[model samples]
Every structure is written in C-alpha cells, then in structure tokens.
Target: MSWTVWTYVVYLLVTVPLTVWVARTLSRNGKVFLEDVFAGNDRLAEAVNTLLVVGFYLLNLGFVSLFLRVDSTVVDVAGVFEQLSVKVGVVALVLGVLHFFNVYVFSAIRRRSRTEARRGAPMPPQAQVAAYGPVPPYAAPYPAPGR
Candidate 1:
C-alpha cells in the first residue's frame, strides 16, 4: 500500500539470498568452529545450514514488515532513497546475526564430538555393567564360566 512496503519487499528479496550465500560460503570453507558445531558430519552440517537459512528468512521478513508499518514516509526520490538505505542497513545486520549463529552452533557440536572421541568409545550397556560390577539378574551374565 505504501512505498515503504515496496521498499521492504525489495529489501527482503535482495538480502535473504545474500545472507544464505554468505552462510553457504562459510560452510564450504569449513573452519574449526563450523566443523566443531556440525560434529564433522557433512550431511548434518548441510541440514543445519538449511535450517539457519530458513530462520534467516523468517527473521528478516518479519523485520522488514515491521519496519514498513512504522512511520517511515518519504515525500520524494530523496526520501525513497533514504528509506532504502535504512532498509538495506537493517537487512545487512540481520544477515550478520544469522551468519554468526550458524557458526556458533556447529562449532559446539564438533567440539562435543571431539571430546567424546578423545575419551575412547563408551562401553555398551552390558559392558558398562561388566566394567563396574556384575550384571543385573535380568541382563543374563556372560557364558556362565564358559560351559
């Protein structure tokens, strides 16, 4: 209905893809933080990236819509340009936040998995019981003295 609405729509159309592209580029580069957060699994990493992109879309779109509703009216070409500048600036900010969040989350997963691996594989349920003491009656003991 207003020029601000059109500007907001254009802002989303341009910046959401840019944000996703930046995130994907960072993913492809595979830094320690990204690998740590994604647990070094390529499939899981891509899936997490996809989720972040979706969240970015939702967040940016909502922000643009909200900004449109605010009292941001411009009387002429200069005014429209001013609104565009503000809109683009905000979009850039949202993208930065999404980029950092993606990096932070994946790094956490990678670090957790690395810690687990360093500790050696965990004992299976039965092995755990055997390691600590005897098994519970329902668990059935090992081979009863080998026949």
Candidate 2:
C-alpha cells in the first residue's frame, strides 16, 4: 500500500517489458542492414544484441534507483504515483530516442559499407593513374631486339 512499493511496481511493470520489446523490434528490423553494417557476421549481431541489452538494463536500473531516491519526503500514494509516472515516462522517451539512434547509426554504417562495395574494386597496379601511358605489348622487345 506504500507509495514506494507502488512506485517500484509501476517502474518495473513499464520498464522491463518495454525495453525487451524495443530490443526485439530493433533486432528484427535491423537484420536486413546488419549484414551490410558488419559484413553479415551473425556473431557480431549477437554480440551487439548482448551489449545493447546489458546497456539497456544498466541505464533503466540506474534511472529506477535514482527516481526512487527523490528528496520529496512525501509519503502519499498520489505523490509517489505522480513522480513515478513522470520518471517512467521520461525513461520511455529516452529509450525510444536511444533506439532511434542505434538504428540510424547502424543504418549509416551499412550505407557506407554498401557504397564502398559498390564502388569499383581497387584499381590494378598497372591501371593506376601513375601508369596511364600506353604500355608496350608483352610481345615487344624489352630493349629494341638489336640490343
């Protein structure tokens, strides 16, 4: 019945499942681009997924712990709910923004990789700008056969 208890319940109720949902959605939607971003390495994608989940847990836990420590000193259920709602709402917003940032960054990386791939491969040594002059055919004498 205490406000602290309610605050905790709401915090967990909202944060845990939401984070899982976002991570799932991201992993699913980002699959198409992940291959390009990290060279189709499933292991890298798994690592990224693990890292993201860990980071999400740490950040959301920090937010919950900090939110619970507010100095208001008020013990009313209403006050607790009000502050908890605001805190959880802010956390949701932050998660959304972070999700978008993750997607955008990876998308950019993927685009850069694709661009690099699409560009013609490295020029052969002989075709480089420094070697533009017409080369004598392989059959030509190395030094005017008379030499």
Candidate 3:
C-alpha cells in the first residue's frame, strides 16, 4: 500500500479507538453527575446521558472523517508519520475542546439546579409584590403646610 494509505490507516486506528474510549469514560462517569444534577431522577439522567454519548460520538467521528484526507502526498514512512502526527494531534485537540465544552455546559446546568433547589419554588410575581408590600411615594424632607 502507498504511504498515504498507510497514513490514513494509522490515523483511523489511533483516533477511532481513542474517541470510543473517551466517550465511554464520559458516559460512565457522567451518569452520577447527571443524576445529581437532575435531582435523583434516574430515568431522566440516563436518558440525558445516552443523548450526550450519542452527540459525542457524532461530533468526534465527524471530525475524524473530515480530517482524514491529506493535503500533500505521503511518499515514505517518515512522511506518513508526519502526516499522521498532524492529523492525530488535531483530532486530540478537537476532542479536548469538545469535552471541556460539555463539562462547562453541564456544570452551568448543575449550578442552576442547585441554586433553584436551595431557593425552593419561586414565588409568583403578584405574590412577590404582595409579600414585599407596596412601595410608598417619595416624601420631601420638609413637611407640608399642615405639618
């Protein structure tokens, strides 16, 4: 086989498994976090976890496939290695970015949920105004003629 074909082979061999491993790891570990975030809703947590894993697979695989093509011809073993390194490096970076993004989003959701739980159910707008009472009109420092 040609060096270009070898480069593609090596790239796929490294990236595909790496993607699967990372996705599985995230899904396995994220379940507990999701459960907590969803306030012990196991069904919802599992459903969201599955959806996240599916999304992760779609994004990583799409990136890997899109990046598989080499711009230049790979002539030898060194060239193949060099090409593979660049491709794999880019794939790794993309994966890391995606991972961090997912973490940030979930963290934000978790934080919001925790805050809401602490605050309990929100009061309606009318109830809020009633609870606080009506605002009095501003009064001048000096009294009127009547004193």
Candidate 4:
C-alpha cells in the first residue's frame, strides 16, 4: 500500500478510537453535571446526555470523514507521519473545542439554576434610605474664567 493509504489507515485508527474514548468519558462524567444543571432531574439528564452523545458522534465523524482527504500525495513513511500528525492533531483540537463548549454551556446553565434556587423570594430592604434631591454639580478645581 502507498503512503497515502497508510496515512489514511493510521489516521482512522487513531481518530476513531480517540473520538470514541472522548465521547464515553464525556458521557460518563457529564451525567452528574447534567443532573446538577437540570436540578436533579435524572430522566432529563439521561435524555440530554444521550442527545449530546449522538450529536457529538455525528459532528466528529462527519468532520473526520470530511477532513480525511490528503491535500498532497504521501510518498513515503515520513509523509505518512506528517499527514497523520496534522490530521490527528486537528481532530484532537476539534474534540477539545467541542468538549469545552459543552462544559461552558452546561456550567452556565448550572450557575443560573443554582442562582435561581438560592433566590427563593424577594426580601424587603434591610433599611430604607430617604431619597435625597439631586445634588448640585461638583465645583471644578479652578473657577471658570467667565465666572
């Protein structure tokens, strides 16, 4: 087999497993996070988790397939290594981006949920302050020449 073929094979071997591992890890660990974000709704958490996993797979695999094409001919082992490195590195970066995005979104949701939970009912002011009339403008360091 030519170097391009070898590169494709190795790239698939690395990226597919890496994607699978990441998806599994995220799904496993993200359950608790999702639960918290959903305010302990287990069924909702599980459903969201499943949907996220499916979307992850579809996006990652689609990207992998689209990015599999080698721009230049791979003539030797070095070429294969070079191509594989770029491809796999890009895939890893993409995965990291996706992971971080999900975390950020869910973390925001969790924060909002927690904040809402904490704010049960509005409380009256501890002490009321009388409104003062609008204050006059502050004097300048030096009086205006025309003053």
Candidate 5:
C-alpha cells in the first residue's frame, strides 16, 4: 500500500479509539453533574447522558470519516506522520472544545437549578410600610439631658 494509504489507516486507528475513550470518560464522569443539573432526576439524567454520548459518537466519527482524506500525496513515512499529526491534532482539539462546551452548558443548568431551589416561596412581607413619609423623630426612653 502507498504511504498515503498507510497514513489514512493510522489516522483511523488513532482517532477512533481516542474518540471512544473520551466519550466513555465523559459519560462516566459526567453522570453526577448531569444528575445535579437535572435536579437529581436520575432517570432523566441517564437518558440525557445516553443521548449526549450517542450524539457525540455520531458527530466525532462522522467528522473522522469526512476528514480522512490526504489532500497531498504522502510519499514517505515522515509525510505519513506529518499528516497524522495534523489530522489527529484537529480531532483532539475538537474533542476538547466539545467537552468544555458541554461542561459549560451543564454548569449553567446546575447553577440555575440551584438558584431556583434556593429561592423558595417568597417570604411574607416582614413588615408592611404603613406610609412613605419620613416625619418620625427619635423618642428616647429617657428625656434628653434637658428636654
């Protein structure tokens, strides 16, 4: 096989496994966060987590396949390595960006949920403002030195 073919093969071998590992890690480590984000609704959290993993797999694998082409001919082992570096580097960067984006979104959800939870039923007015005038004067318990 040509060096270009070899490069393609190696790229697939590296990127696919890396994608799988990242997805698995995210799913596993993200469960608790998701649950909190969903306000401790485990079932909902699990369902959403599964969907996210599926989407992640679809998006990344599709990207890998679509990006597999080597625009220039790979004539040597160095060329193969160079192409692999660029391709794999792009994939890794994409994964990192996606991971951080997911974290940011879920973190926002979690924060909102906690904020709502903290804001329980509004407290009754502690004391109603009888009027809006500032004509009150201090009446000391004991008359001033010489009232």
Candidate 6:
C-alpha cells in the first residue's frame, strides 16, 4: 500500500484505542469524585459520569476523524512518518487539554462542595446583615456627614 494509506492506518490504530482507554480511565476514576461531589448520590453520580463519558467520546472521536486527513500528499515513508507525527501529536495534545479541563472543572466543584460542607447551609442576606451588624452609613458610596 501507499504511504498515505499507511499513514491513515497508523493514525487510526493509535488514536482510536487511545481515546477508548482515556474515556474508560476517566469514567472509572471519576465515579468516586462524582459521588463525592454529589454528596453520596450514587445514582446521580453514575448518570453524570455516563454523560461525561459519552461527551468525551464524541468530542475526541470527532476531533480525530476531522483531523485524519493529511494536508499534503505523503510522498514516501519519511513523509508518512512526518504526517502521522503531526496528526497523532495534535490528538495527544488535545486529549491532554481536555483531560486537564475536566479535572479543573470537577476539582472546582469538589472544592466548592467541601467549602459548603464546612460552612453548613448558606446564611440568608438578612441573617448576614444581622450577624455582622448593619452596614455603617459611612461605608456607603455617599459622602459622610462631616465630609
């Protein structure tokens, strides 16, 4: 077969399995975090985890498919390697970026949950004012009496 065909084969071989492996890894490990974030709601956590997995598959596979085509013709084995390198490299980079994004978002949710748990239920606005005492008149944007 031609180098172009080989390039396509290699790209598919590399990206498809990589995508599946990443999705599975994330789904498996993320369940615990999701459960914690949902505060022991296992059903809700499972549902959200499934949804996230589906979304991850769609995005990664779509990107892989879209990026499969080489911009230039592969002239030889070297060209094939070069093209594959660029394609697979981009896919790897995108995968890392998406993974990091998911981690960051989930971490934020977990952190917020921890904070709320520590603080208990939120205080109402009036309760806050009452607890802290009324806002001083001088604290307002308007000028003070002597000013």
Candidate 1 residues 1-147, lDDT tens each?
566666656666766576657655665665444445655666766676566556666776676567554365656566667777776777678767766776676567667777887898667899777779974778655676667
Q: For model 1, which pairs clash?
A: 36-107, 36-110, 37-106, 37-107, 37-109, 38-106
| Candidate 3 clash figure, as a count | 0
lDDT per residue (tens digit) for residues 49-76 in model 5: 9999999999999999999999999999
lDDT for 114 (candidate 2): 83
Per-residue lDDT tens digits of candidate 2, residues 20-56? 7876776676665675578879888778767776786
lDDT of each: 0.65, 0.73, 0.91, 0.92, 0.92, 0.92
Candidates 1 and 2: which is better by lDDT?
Answer: 2
> Best candidate, TM-score-wise?
5
Model 5 residue runs over 4 Å out of place are 123-147
Looking at candidate 5, the ten consecutive residues that score lowest on lDDT are 126-135
Give the distance in Å from residue 141's predicted Cα in candidate 1 to where it truly belongs: 34
Q: CA shift at 49, candidate 5, in angstroms?
A: 0.5
* Residue pair clashes in candidate 3: none
Cα lDDT tens digits, model 4, 1-147, are 888888999999999999999999999999998998999899999999999999999999999999999999999988998998899999999999999999999999999988999887854454222244444579466778987
Model 1 global lDDT (CA atoms, 0 to 1) = 0.65
Off by over 4 Å in 1: 1-13, 16-40, 121-147
TM-score of each: 0.57, 0.69, 0.81, 0.82, 0.83, 0.80
Identify the runs in model 6 with alpha carbons over 4 angstroms from their true place.
Answer: 121-147
Candidate 6: C-alpha lDDT:
0.92
Q: How many clashes in each candidate?
A: 6, 0, 0, 0, 0, 0
- Model 6 TM: 0.80
lDDT of 3 by residue, 39-140 (tens): 999999999999999999998999999999999999999998899888899999998999899889889999998888788776789998799886567956
Ranking by TM-score: 5, 4, 3, 6, 2, 1
Better of 3 and 4 by TM-score: 4
